[model samples]
Target: MKNKEFIFLMILAAFLSATESYALDIEFSGSRHTVIKDKPEASTGLNDVFTIYDIKEVSFISIGNIIAPSDFRVLIYSNLGGGYAIEQPVSITGTTAFIHNPKGDMGYIVEDGDNRYCFWVVDYAGKHFDISSIEAYPEQDCDMTKITVIGSGDQIRYYSVSGRQCTLSRNIELSYNTLEWDNENNSYSLVEKTAGFEYLQTPLTLRPPFYCNTTVTVSGDRFLKTWGLGKTLESSIIEANGIDVNTEAVQTNLAPDDASNMIKSDGTMLGGSAPADFTFYAYVTDAVLHNEWQIADDPEFEYVRYRFNERDLTYTFDQEGKFYVRFIGSNADGSCEATGETYEIGIGASDLRIPNVFSPDGDGVNDTWKVGYRSLVEFKCWIFDRNGHQLFYFDRPELGWDGKHHGKTVSPGVYYYVIEAKGADGKKYKKGGDINILRYRKIGNSSGASGE
Candidate 1:
């Protein structure tokens, strides 16, 4: 299979350089002209060469300094032994002439058979005239179903005749065939034919090229069905004159800087519950024409939790750390992703410590033991008594307990407390410790005795 493909490519290259065997001549009445050299005026000017692959809808020719109907009459010669003049109307802008097939005609397709035809622009009165460049465009109803490339490689993708990426699918019967060559007999024979593959029953409009060792398959259907119906598919081999596919437009190239530190509100290393804000920065190159930007933390990008403008290129990290950001930029062809640098946030316990002891004797000194929190984005504390009773609960570290239970003072005892907090780096922390309640003894003396 590989050898055959190599041979096919070589043949294609040779054919591309081969000159057309047929030619069209324009005769003059007074001053006869034999051959029209490729001069800028007569033979040189057309934006592109006329071919069925590049031209789907209509063909436009720009001939400079063309004299109205009286100067030249256009004719086409077909090896079918027939010569005919084009009756189509020619529109002109300045000195450039525009030619089109007559109304209700399917434009023009250069015949591929031995009886091929050549187009000629000549002076109607046998006067000399110059021909410039010619260009072709897809007509409203051009047929391309007869040509196709069957492969399963990445290069196989759907594109409009105008060279824009497209999506389309059509029901097509695919068949695989191979040729067998006999060494002694020096003859070639068909070896096998398999057309029952369900995967090939319906060929996707966007088919990739097949790798080596893959079977050669052909589409049974003539044309591909596009957005609606009757849309045609063109071959992609450059030498074959297919639309010029722009590969870079579908490429993905984007990156985000690595190794970001989780910081406190003061831009210092986040410790405990500091409420700091940090930004993640990424960039998409100007050369990449991507239509979608994807940002996620999961390696597979299961979901995207945040988004930032392409120009801004920033993602604010509010409280979570050890983030694995993935940035993907893509178009219709495929997608590429960049795994950004990981950021780890460590909030030191010293910044958010809880006092082990406090007294609430109503004397205004050490009335409550509040959980110490520095730069905390979120804080929660739960206090439980020795018997497993939840004595107090608060989300703010500043909102501490007053040593009261059900509106009554509880007996002095040791209590257990749990603390949970989120720092500015977007990290969660949990710690628990024991707390002691101390009360001064009240001296009961009837005789004006002051309590010590």
Candidate 2:
């Protein structure tokens, strides 16, 4: 029983393999222009059709390896009037049939048993189209432009700058083999191809309703070789210049010992000690005839403090208050004006305080000795041991010193700190205090001495 089942399975496998291997080999003969074997775009509904470019008025097609020679029939159809089949004579020799003098842009169907093979023949001997020039015409309306393509072709395709297809109009349609007849089902069905792959008639001219930065491409049948050269036209509509105001608050004057004051603020809103110097810069997309920088006390600019007509400005904020700054740019006619981003500048009064106690344990609570500061522009801090040996030093008020020297934790005892600073409000700071580091010693652990 097992041997018989195995034998039956082998026979079935052979039958299936033989069925899958059966294919009709179709060949074209005679002097032809060219043959484009590349598969058509899936949207063309001609996935199974092979394009044949013929220069001569006539061409021959040979269909060989027919499963049944008597059952093979070669049928030709026109692309017009819903595709009507033309009566063409076929000469048969052995298992092959010869099709004589097929027409251009016509569909050919070869029927053998329940299988049907289809293809398209494009005549390339007489088709002629070329792109002369492309021009752009601006309209009276803003951002409205008319683009004209001076060329001729059977169809035209539009593309973007990045080579993406753009839809022109959906109502336009070109005739091609979009449907195939099913012999076994005895009915006509739509071809298994993606939709919206149709091309438009050439000599195209259209004005886009809106304005954008894009690239336009015009081409005929992309799959054909004899089709004329494709031309790309770039159209850019110029508009008013865009303006942006970039600001930076920099401290130019530094104390002789405060060399680490390298932090600069470059944002719309900034808060620091008074007497800050800020440089304003204007970035414009196009040329501007007039550029002005304005500083006001209120956001609405009800009372303007200062106004400067320049491309860039360096202003000093000596008073303690919130100020609003903006930049304006305009064209020669002044009809087109653009305002840049508004900057909010805040100047605070200066004050500084130092902490007396801090725990440097791993609990993350006050792990470092840091000073309580408000707008101290120029600062210098030093941490020293009882032996007068400096352990850490910093020139910025925001920086702190952990209770470690040379990568080792110092002894939990009172340390000393000295600070010399100057505020933006012209105040001076000269202070010194003791910093105590309190740590709980673990069992059987000895307190390590301070590192040098």
lDDT of model 2, residue 319: 61
RMSD of each: 22.2, 17.3
TM-score of each: 0.24, 0.45
Q: Measured by C-alpha RMSD in angstroms, how accurate is candidate 1?
A: 22.2
Q: Candidate 2 on 1-452: residue-level lDDT in tens?
A: 25564344323322221244556666667744445544434333232344444535346777788877777776554443112344468988998888876666565655577555554555544444444554443332222223454544443222221123333222221111123335465433443222122333332323222222234443444534243333333323323222222333333532333322332244446545544667877654343578888999999988989999988888877666788888887666675556777788887777787788887775656776777665566888889999899998888676687777876777899999999988766788999989988874423323432333
Cα lDDT tens digits, model 1, 81-163, are 11221234556565454555321112121222222222322211211111121112122111111113333212212221112
Off by over 4 Å in 1: 1-317, 320-350, 441-452
Residue 178 C-alpha lDDT in model 2 = 22
